[model samples]
Target: GNRAEQKEDLRQLVGLTAGSDDKALLADITLRRASMYLATADYEQAVKQAQQATALVATHDNKTLEARAYRIWGRAQWQQGRANAAKPLLQRALRLATAAKDVLEQAQNYYDLGQIAFLNNQFSEAQQLLHQAIDLFKVEDDKRNMIRCLDNLGSIAILSESNFEAALTYFQDSFRMCQSIHWPYGETYVLYHLGNCYFEIGDFAQSQETLGKTLTLTRLLGDRAAEANALDTLGLAYQFDGQLEQARAKFEEALAIHDSLNDRRGKAYVQTHLGILLSNLEEIEQAGIYLYDALSARSDSGAKETTIDTEAALAWLDMARGDSDFAQERAQEIAAWLQENGTAGVELPFQVFWQCYTVLKLTGAAEEAQSLLQLAYTQLMARTQKIQDEDLRAHYLESVVYHRQIIEAFEATTR
Candidate 1:
C-alpha cells in the first residue's frame, strides 16, 4: 500500500480498538499512527496521536512505548521550530528509555539533543552528542541512525566551523552509505550539503549541479522546506557565477516558499541574499531596503552570522553611494564587533575590512587605508593557507592578487 493508505489503515486499526479493554494495544496503535503522521509532516495529527498514547500509558508499565510516544511528540514540536517546547519532552523520553534499558531509543534521544545543539550553534556539544549517538547506533547496527549522525556531523563542519574539506569527507561517506542502503532520503540530504560545500569552496558549477539534484528529490518528496533551502543555495551558486538574473529569480522563488510556510528564518536568509545580490547589481536604494528588512528579521530570529552579513552589505551600499566616511565607520564598527565576539575567522569580516579600506582610500585617509589593507591581506593569507583543496586555494590566491592590485592602485593615486 501507499504511505497515505497505510496511514489510513493504521488509523482504522486504532478506531477498531477504541472500544476494547486492551489499553496497551490501543496505545501502541496510536503511537505507530503518530509515527506515520510525523513521517508525512502531519505534525498536528502526529501530536494528537502521541498525546493520546501518552495519556493511555501514563500510569502503565510500558515504559518503552511511552518513551516512543514522547519522542515522536518531541520530534513533531522540533520540526515545527518549537525547540524549547520539545526539549523537556525529549528529556523525559530519554529518562524513560534509560529506565527501560532501550538502547535504540536512548540513541535516538541523543541524536535529537545533538540536532538541537547544532541548531543553537553549539558545535562542540553537538559533535560530542552526535558521536555518542553514532557509537550506540553502531552497537545496534542501525544504519539509518548512523547515516543521520554522519550527515549532522558534516553539517556542523560546514555551517559551524567552515571546515569544508572535512565536511566533504563526512558527506561523501554518508552518501556512499545511503546509496548502499538504497536510502534516497538520506542521499538527497547529503547532496544538499555537498552542494553547499562546493559553493563555499567556489565550485559554482558543481554546486549548481548538485543542488539541482537536491531540488528534484525534495520536490518529489513533497518537502517544501528542503526545496526552498535548495533553491536558496542554488541562488548563491548563480550569484557567485555572475548570473544575477537567475540568482534573483531563485531567491524570489525561495522567498515565496518561505512566506507560504511562514518561516521567518528562511525569509530572513533569502532577504539577506537578495539584498547582497541587489547591492552587487548597484541597485542601492532597493538593496538598502532589503538589507534593513533582513537585518531586522535576522536580529529577531537571532541569526548572528546573517545579521553581521547584512550589516556589511549595508556598509558596502553606503560606499557605493559615495558616503565614504559613514561607510568606513559602519564597516569598522562591524569589524570591531566581530573581533570582540571572537568571530574574526569568517569571510564576512574580511569582506568588511576590504570595504573599510576602500572607503578610507576614497576619503583620502591613505595611512588608515594602508593599515586596513595590510590587516585584510594577513587575514586572507591565513584563510587561504587553511584551504586544503588546490583549486579552492588558487581561488583565494586570485582574490588576494585582486585585492593587492586595488591597494597598489590606491597607493599610486595617493602618491
Candidate 2:
C-alpha cells in the first residue's frame, strides 16, 4: 500500500464527510484521518484531527470511538516528545477500550505503552507490556504487530542484559513470521539485526552471510539507508575477522552512501570505523584525517560516542604513529573510563586493556601488563558464564578475536 496515496484518499473522504448528519461516522473517519496524519509525522495536525473526533463523540454514547480518538491524540503527543502529556490520555483510552470490550484497541494501547517504557529504559516493564500486547495480537491474528513486538522484546533482551541467546530466539521468531507473510521489507530489517547479533556473538561466518543477504535485499528494495547499514556492519565483521582491506572497502562504500544521503551521523560513524581500520593498517596520516573529521562531525551532532570511540581510535592512531608514551596515556584514560562507567553492552574495556597491555609489557611493566590482561580475561570469563548456550559459548571463546587474543596472550606469558 502506498501510504501517501492512502492518505490522499482518506483526506478526500474526510472532506466529503464534512458537516454530515451522521456524527458517529464522521468521528470514526476523523479519528482514522488523525492516525494517517500521525503516520506521516504531522503531530500538530494529528492532534487537531483527534480533538475534532473527541468533540464529535462528546455527547454520543461511543466508547470505542472515544478510545480511538484519545489513542491518536496520545500517540501524537508522545511523538512530539511529550510523554507526560501522552501517558494519561493513553491510560484513559485503554480504560475506555477495556470497558467497551475492544480487544484490538486494548492491544494497541498496550503496544504504545510498551514503546513508551522501552524509550524510558524501563526494559522490564516494557517486556511485560509487550508480552501482554503480543498475547492479544495473537488472539487477533495480528502477525505484523506480533513481529514488531518480538523485535522489541529481542532488543530488550540485548539492551537490558547481554542475553544474546534470548535475543537470537526472538529475532529468529520474527524472521520466520516475516517469511511466512512474504514481506521482503520486514525480512530485510530482521536480517540486519540478526547480522549484528551474530557479529556480537562472534559467529563471523554467519554474520557475513546474513549481512550479504541483507545487502542483496536492500539493493533489491532500493533501501539506501538499509544498504549503508549493511555495508557498515559487514565491514565490522571483516574488520574483526582480521580482513583489514575488505573492511576498508566496505567502510568506504558505506561512507559514500552516507555522503550521498547527507546522513551526517552515518558518515561520522563510518568515518570513525575507517579511521580505526586505517590505524590497524598503520596508515597513520589517513587514519588521522578520518578520525579528526569524525571527531568534529560527532561533536557538532552531539553524538555521545564523540569521546569514547573517536578518542579510542585516536589512541590507536597514536600507537600506529610510534608514539608509545602518548598512546599509553590516552589508552589508560579511555580504558579507565570504560572500566568505571562501562559501555552500552559491549566488551570495549577488554579491547582497550588488550591494546595497552602490549605497551606496558614493552615499557618494563611486564608484571603489570600480565595482571591487566588477566583482569580483562577474568571479566570476559564472567560474562561467558552467564551464557547458557554451549555452541554460542564456544563461538564466543574461539571465534571472537579479542577473546582468543587475550587467552593466547595470557597462555604465552605462562609458557
In candidate 2, list every pair of residues with a backbone clash.
none
Task: Supply the TM-score for candidate 2.
Answer: 0.71
lDDT of 2 by residue, 1-415 (tens): 3455677798899788888889899899988888777754466888999999999999998999999999999988765546667889999999999999999899989988887776555678899999999999999999888888888888777667778989999899999999999887778878898998898788988999999999998887666767888999999999989888899999999999887766665777788889888887778898899889877876663424344677767877887788878877776776566556555523244566676676666655666677678777777787788789999999888988778889898888779
lDDT of 1 by residue, 1-415 (tens): 1455666688788778878877788889888888877766567788999999999998789999999999999988777656667889999999999999999999999999887777666789889999999999998999989999998998888666557778889999999999999887778789998998787776788899999999988877667778888999999889877789999999999989887766666777788889878877888888888788877876764546547767777777888887777887777776566545644223345556665666666777777767666665655566566778887776544533344554464456557
lDDT of each: 0.78, 0.81
Q: After superposition, how far is residue 49 of candidate 2 from its true place, in Å?
A: 14
Write down the TM-score for model 1. Answer: 0.82
Error of 1 at 404 (Å): 9.3
